[model samples]
Target: MNPKVTDYISSNIKWQKELEIIRNVLLELPLEEDIKWGIPAYIYKKKNIMGLSAFKNYCGLWFHHGCFLKDEINILINAQKDKTKGMRQMRFISVDEIDTDIVKQYVLEAMANSEAGLEVKPKKNTNPVVIPEELNIQFSKNEKLKYKFNEFTLSKQREFCEYILSAKREATKQSRIEKIIPMILNKIGLNDKYRNC
Candidate 1:
């Protein structure tokens, strides 16, 4: 067991028992502890294998390969609605809610999946709008904004541009552009400011 992670989890009584149970189960596996998304994440090799966290009403045992796992326990929850094929979550309302046998099976399967090299299907691109001429004009006018936008990686630029052009109405598109211009100028990528670094 990792002393740092155990110490962190020990502070929360409700989560302590749950973490202890999970830690005991995964004892034989090669594991490391790190903080990810502000939660305690467990890694196998270099891949994120699982995470333990508490929510408002439940504690979560998240599987990084959950979307691919055959959930015999039927306790897994699809946490992300926008993405169809990545990282499923298993929520436990209480320590009693966990099925230790099933969780161990899942951990073993996840390790095997990692060894076999499986990846989630990438999300499809749904937006089809081209960049507006007016937006291009605005970008051209602000040299700093243009430079900042250029400094962003292709994927990051695509995210901001897609967000602006994806709106159904011209008014909404303009509104989004207005809201995002300062973010672009500040060299912050979409979702970067909100995500815990």
Candidate 2:
């Protein structure tokens, strides 16, 4: 275990024993420790394998490719109802909620799947728009907007694009574009604009 991660684990005692057990299972796998999404993440060859996190009422062991695994142990939970596939979470309400052996087997299987390059096929895009022509045109015409949009993080850009293109009607798309233009021109991300308000 990485010393930093060990220290992180040691700092929290609410579910110390349970966390320890889960840690042992994860450490046994050939994985590397890194910080991702502001939390301790385990990766195999650059692909995320799993992550450890704590919540107000529960702690979770997240398998990045959990949706791809044939979960006979029935350990997976659908955290989001709208998401059809790609990620799943196993939440533990308390120390006693953990099943060490079963969790270990799941961890092992997750690692094996990672090593084998297994992946859940991404959901196909169902939106009607074939990329926004306005986005390209607006971006090309405005150097400041282009710079700001480029400066925004990948997730932020994705959010903006998804929000704009998510509209089913042309009027809604135009309205979204109108709302987003100033935010982009000002070098502010979609969430940042809302957050500051």
Tens-place lDDT per residue, model 2, 27-138, is: 7777798656655688887888888887768787888888777898787987875874667888898777888788877877887887887887675555543437767777
RMSD in order of candidates:
3.9, 6.2
Per-residue accuracy of model 1 over 109-137 as CA lDDT, tens digit each = 88888878876767655655355665688
Runs of candidate 2 exceeding 4 Å displacement = 121-143, 150-158, 161-197
Whole-model lDDT, candidate 1?
0.76
Model 1 TM: 0.72
Error of 2 at 196 (Å): 21
Error of 2 at 163 (Å): 6.9
Clashing pairs in 1: none
